[model samples]
Target: MPLVRIDLNQGRTAAQLREIADAVQEVMLDVFAAPPGDRYQIVTEHPAGQVIAEGSGLGIERSDALVMIQVFHQGRSVEQKTRAYAGLSRILAERAGLAPGDLIVSMVENTKEDWSFAGGRAQFLTGEL
Candidate 1:
């Protein structure tokens, strides 16, 4: 599953949020060939003063937003990952209206062996009952 966290300004409507999420998911599907069922998105809106960018040397800009995406997949090579990143960045810049450099997107991989659900009692990798 891909869990995407979008931290943006507290001004967008629900429709805007849904559109952004859909665009992001489309990138993953197109670039990485991911299935629709394996994707999930969480958008969190923050107040003006809650987030700050250190390197900017100024207060956080209203337009600044952080998008973090964690993808759990199997056997994806560096080349594939690189392509996905590029595609995601481009899509976010064009569709989401975020400056390409300002958007901080990250991907994390996990083997089924390292994940669990149901209060950690059910191991995903081992299929424990």
Candidate 2:
């Protein structure tokens, strides 16, 4: 599952969020080859005053958006992860209406033993399981 956290300047509508989701889903599907039916995303909007940016030590100025995407998967190689991050960053920059340097993505890979789903009732035993 991919947990996407999008932090944008507080002025976006529901339609904007949906559009971002669509663009992100497309990147996930095309770059990571993730199944269309198997994807998860969470979009969070933060005001400029609350978030602490990297360079400015302040919230994003202007109409900038801070996107922090975290991806979780099993048995993925470094190359795959790299490609996923790169593809996502590129797509978000190109399609999500963000500056190229504004998007930041992080990924964490784990074995099947690390995660549980379905209210902790089911553990992912393998990629297929």
lDDT of each: 0.67, 0.67
Give stretches of model 1 more than 4 Å off. Answer: 56-62, 65-74, 115-129
State the lDDT of candidate 2 residue by residue for 42-92, as single tens digits: 777777766545755556343356665666666767777788777776776
lDDT of 1 by residue, 1-129 (tens): 456676666777789778778887887788776665557667788887665444455553434565545565555678878887888778877887766655555667766665454575535565552
What's the lDDT for candidate 2?
Answer: 0.67
Least accurate 10 contiguous residues by lDDT in model 2? 55-64
Q: Give the clash count for model 1.
A: 0
